[model samples]
Structure formats: C-alpha cells, structure tokens
Target: MMVNDKSIVWILKIYLLIIFVFIFMPIITSVVFSFNSDRFPSLPLGHFTWNWYDKVYYDSETWDAIRTSIIVALSASVLATIIGFCTAYTDFRYSFRFKNAYLALALLPPTIPLIILALAMLAWFSKLGISGQIWALIIAHTVLGAPFAMAIIRLRLQQMDKDLESAAWNLGASEWATMRHVIIPFALPSIISALCLTMAVSFDEFAIAWFVSGLNKSVPVVILEILQGNVDPQINAIGSFVFATTMTLVVIAQLFLFTKKPNNH
Candidate 1:
C-alpha cells in the first residue's frame, strides 16, 4: 500500500512538472530572446537591453494595430455576450421544436475549419457590399465568441436555484424585475467570466482575423507582417509583453471575482 501511494505521488508530481514546463518554456524563451541586444531574434549569449521595447513604443503601425485590436475585441465580446445570454436564457426558459438544432448551428462555426468560416463570411460580406473592413472582423468574431459565452453562462444558469427567481415572480415582480434583481446578480460572476474569456479569444485570434479583417490591420496581422519582412527581435519583445500583460490581467480578474471568502458558507 505504501509503495503504491508513493508511486502515485511521484507520477502526479512528474505530470504537474511536465505540464508547467510545457506551458511556460516558450514564454520564458520569448522573454529571454526579447532582451537580447541582437536585432535578430536569436539565442545563447548577448548583452541585455530595453531597446526592443523602446522600438515598440515608437512604431506607429504597431500602436495603430493595438488600438484597432482593442476596439474590435471589446465590441465583439460585448455583442457576443449579450446575444449569447439572450439565446441561453430563452433556450433554458422555453421549449420549442428544433431548439437543439438552433444551438448546434450557432456553435458549428467554432468547431469548423476557420478558413472555411472566413471564406463563407467573406462571401456573405461581399454580397452585402461590406467586405474587407473592421466591421466585418467584429461581426465574425462576435459570431465565434457567442458560442463560448452561451456555453459558460448556460452552465452557470443550470446550476442556479430557479426558486429564487420564481419567488420574486410569485411576489408580484415582473419578469424583467425578477431577472434583473435575482438572476443577473447571482450569475454576475459567470457573466463576467464569459465576457472576459470572449474578449481574450477575440484579442488573440489570428486566423479568422487574418481573413475578415479586410483592409484594417489588427495587431496579429501587423505582427505577422512585421516578422515576415524582418527577423526583428522587437517583435519578440512586443509579443512577450502582450502575453505577460494578458496573463496578469486574467489572473487578477479571476482572483478578484472567484476567490472564496471566509464565512461565506
């Protein structure tokens, strides 16, 4: 028994170590390379400097792309979360024929080949005379983000106590009031989580963005263009900084919202 327990512990430790290293190795490598004094993104030994980050600061195209990316991500995330909430709430509260089919269709794009979806969107936008613009990208991203938001919020709603909302309705509250006061507050954490996740997905998304972004370049496209032209270490600097900043914000939000407080039970 003792030997088996020890063996299991060793396996678990090894598994965790492997996972951690696998996840962080690339990030560590990027950070190290970003500081290398060489203009080229390369390795072993070089004097470290902040010039790459400084270069990033002065790049107008990079800043423009960053601004564009933020706008697109925020718009897509908010729109998607709202639509998903409405869809999920309706599905949970009502019964109808083909309800499952509707959900399946909404979720199909995320699982399908990104290029195929992009092409379909491209065709649709061209038909609508709205091809190749930031609006197109926002539309595409919202469509993709909606499924995830729906899944997240639906899970939370499923676990929620329906009696709370029912009680409010029983006391002569309107449907809107019950939901606004009861359901929304109870589900706030999950809603925030879903919204944040959608934002992250839209912010970092590359393939679909590459397709639907049209003439207005987002950060990922701009980064790709810059790297393709020159083996610039500054690209590495920008990437490392973005990755670190994103992770930090995610961690802070999670801790702020999800941490359990003493005496809550």
Candidate 2:
C-alpha cells in the first residue's frame, strides 16, 4: 500500500497548529482579557475598555516597578557585557593555567537553577550585610546574565581572525588601542546581541530579585506583590504589556544583531 503524502502533510500541519495554540493559549487569553471590562479574567466577554491600560499608566507602584526594572536591566546588561567581553577576549587571546576550569566556572551560572542561585546569593549577601540593597540585586543579576553574555561573545571571539590583532600591533597600536580599534569593532554585533539578551534576562528574572530586593523590587516582584493583595485585571494588562515588550526586544535583536554578519575589520 502506498502512503498518502498529502494526508501526512495535512496531519503534521494540524498537529503543529494544535501545538502552537496550546503554547499560546494562556498568552492569547491574557491579551483578550486585558481589554475585558469585567474584573474577572475569564467568563462572558465584556465590552472593550482601556481602563486597565489607563490604570497601569496611573498606578504609581507600576511606574516605580518600570523605573526599577529599566535601571536594573540597563546597569546589569552593560556591566555583564563589559565583563563578559573582557573575559572572553582574555581567554581567547592568551593561554593560562586553569583556563578550561575558568571557562567552566564562568559558564556554570546559566546551568545552575535560578532558584538555587537566588538562595545562594541571598545567603552570601546576607553575610555581607548587603542582602536588602539595590546593589545586591544588581550584582546578582549581573552574575546571572554574564554566563549567557560570555557564551555568545565567546563564540564571536573564537571565530575572529587573530591576524587582525597582529596587524594592529605591527602598526604600533598598544594592546588596549588594538582592542578598541580592531577586536571590539569586529565583535560589536555579538556584544550588542549579548547585551540585549542580558537586558531581557535581567528584566524578567524574578527569583534573585525577589530574595535580594527586600523593599526595593523590580517589575516581576512588584507584580507578585500586587497579585497577593488582589486578583486584578490590571496585573494581567501589565504582564501582557511586559511580555510584548520583551518579545519585541528579542525579535529585534534576532533580526538586526544575530542575523547580520559582523564586519571582520
């Protein structure tokens, strides 16, 4: 008996469609519910209203969370990118004792579960008496984002041509000057993409922020606190907005930074 290829294709298409819907079911529900005039998330669909968006805009706590998230993400991503690029550049340029071990340790954080890392950071910071400080949250998130950033930038660094650095040095450029002109320029794409990834990770990270944030909280922690007080559609609206924003940033990074080939100058 001959297999019907058209039927198989149709079946696979339907299967994929089902999977997509299943995955996005909650997100779709939230988007639809965000415009819901009624207080409850699900049930009879009510008349469309912008009240939730307006509420989010007017809510001081929501604004505070937004401000905190922005500051933390910016500071953390920049620091992570700088640190990651430097580490990757160093590891790539020169051989040292325990190089493999150092790379392994640097890459370990992304493998560790966030909850475990969060607890560890909380304990460490508590011992240092910095557990409740904003700096503590910033440091934890920087560490959390560094592995991913380093891994990305490291890949670019590995692919780089070593002759460029030699040429710069031959032209009488100092090590730092050569890096500024040659290495960093060649690796800018990867660095930018890594920074974007770090920003998104730091913005969305709840576990570490929650444990170390204490009174000062990022957006996710703030949202959790709001939920504990009441079941509000405003929270859903805020969440959906955040989801959209993060997705946009990821998509932009993928399209503009990752897809394009970096100039190897």
Per-model TM against the reference = 0.91, 0.92
State the displacement of the C-alpha of residue 164, model 1, in Å, after optimal TM-score superposition.
1.6
Q: Counting only residues 3 or more apart in sequence or on different chains, how many pairs clash (N, Cα, C under 3 Å) in candidate 1?
A: 0
lDDT of 2 by residue, 65-107 (tens): 8888888899999999888987898798999999999989988
Pairs clashing in candidate 2?
A: none
RMSD of each: 2.4, 2.2
Q: Each prediction's Cα lDDT score?
A: 0.81, 0.87
The residue-by-residue lDDT of candidate 1 on 55-151, one tens digit each, is 9999998898888888988999899989888877877777899998988886777898888988898889889877778899899889989998888
Instruction: Estimate candidate 2's alpha-carbon lDDT, on a 0 to 1 scale.
Output: 0.87
| Candidate 1 lDDT for residue 183 | 79
